[model samples]
Target: MEKTLYVASLFFLCFWTKAQENKPYNYFVQESKIVDSGNTIEVNKKGDTVFVAHYKRQDLINTSNQDFIKTYKGTPFFKNGWYRGKVQTGTGMEWEFVMAYNIQKEEIYLSNNPNMEATVMKPVSFTMEGHTFRQYKNQYYEVIYEGGSQIWKEYGCSLIFSNSSQRTGYEAEGGDEYDGEFLKTVKYYLKEGDRLREIPSKNRLFKLFGSKSNDVKNYAKTEGLNLSKEINLVSLFRYYDSL
Candidate 1:
């Protein structure tokens, strides 16, 4: 009886451990706070926490310490004690940058777009069922399959060029200057596949979906999901594969 009870208890423990392993880690909700001098704590939506300290930035000056050689225009602020800096790559460049210093890990995460306001670095990849998935913001995800085939599905806003015209602008005096105006539109990508194909119109969904259109719509309705929403394409495809 004693041995049987021990065996049953071990089995239950293993089951609980497996359940914890299957829980998804939330990469969203990048929040951080400073605890003390040079110390900061960061937490994600999944409740996983990390403590960082000793954050520092490279001074934008030459060894001579004379005049400013490299200029960084934007001022950095601390969130939960972690310093976020928008470091410009010199002047006359078309790009802005942001970076974070993890003093404990001695690591740095660079922002691809300076125009974005968020400064916290998000986890780029997560594993599910031994398959690795990479996320690019909330727009799309790239799934690396077991056979090494990379499948990408992206849904987001894209600019559409409309029309162009020239308009005259009058300066202080009699000088007149002409400027070109270009119109644009916002559109969303529909459907998921290995390639990003632009949907010219809602009518094109018929061609894109072909005979599977009705089936896909039915499945979406049954699941109470709207395809037009920011759906998780990876999870959607996984459910489709199960069918």
Candidate 2:
């Protein structure tokens, strides 16, 4: 009987050792970024959407590669008007979906970094002080934002978003001026020291459209560029050189 007991104890030790050797990997998600400590998975490319799953059991059935998606809402701060942009805050708030703007045709363009592809367009149209701006389908807003002082080179005869709410009066970023729904006049400047301004004049929109005046300015203060007609090769080499 003692021999039998000794054999059983040896078998238990071997089983425990095997279990420790085959521990499952651990992973955590943050915003759009994912980190795996166990080195179990790999990301083949950037901006490539992937599926993730959580495990509650020890068995393979306890694990999953299910897809999970997050959503976010952003307010615009352009001279045009307020817009609702989408955001995804998975795991942590590291990943974001940003919309690029185009001044030529006066439209909003959506894209991720490294790749500039026009996916969706947020139509903007409104009248301010008897002036009207419309997207009209033919025109589009393409977001051609390049980080750093490179934004200054974007000034031209075309209209561009200041990228900040405190900015007003436009300076040529892509064009000499900005034209669209949110802006009252064709020629305007979006200077750095300008006051945080909006189109439709809060009081005027409230009196004319019967819409909330402060609400209009509030939305524009946070989001820029309203709807309008629109008409770019983005030369990164030139942009970098301008820096």
**Backbone clash numbers for all candidates listed:** 3, 53
TM-scores vs. true structure, each candidate: 0.25, 0.17
TM-score of 2: 0.17
The residue-by-residue lDDT of candidate 2 on 1-243, one tens digit each, is: 698657654743554455446444222222223232222111224532222222232235857443322211111223322233442222122212344333433444333432322333433532222323333234422223334311111211222232322112343355322121122223211112332112232234333222343554454445442323111112321232343
lDDT of 2: 0.30
Model 2 lDDT at residue 85: 46
How many residue-pair clashes does candidate 1 contain?
A: 3
For 1-243, candidate 1 gives per-residue lDDT tens digits of 698667655743554465346433211111212121232344545553433322223335743321111111111111222233433222212222344432222222444444432223333443222323344443323343212112343322211212222111222443221111112223434324444455444334435445666775566667876444434333344454555
Q: Candidate 2: minimum summed lDDT over ten consecutive residues — where? A: 68-77
**Model 1 misplaced regions, further than 4 Å:** 1-195, 198-207, 232-235
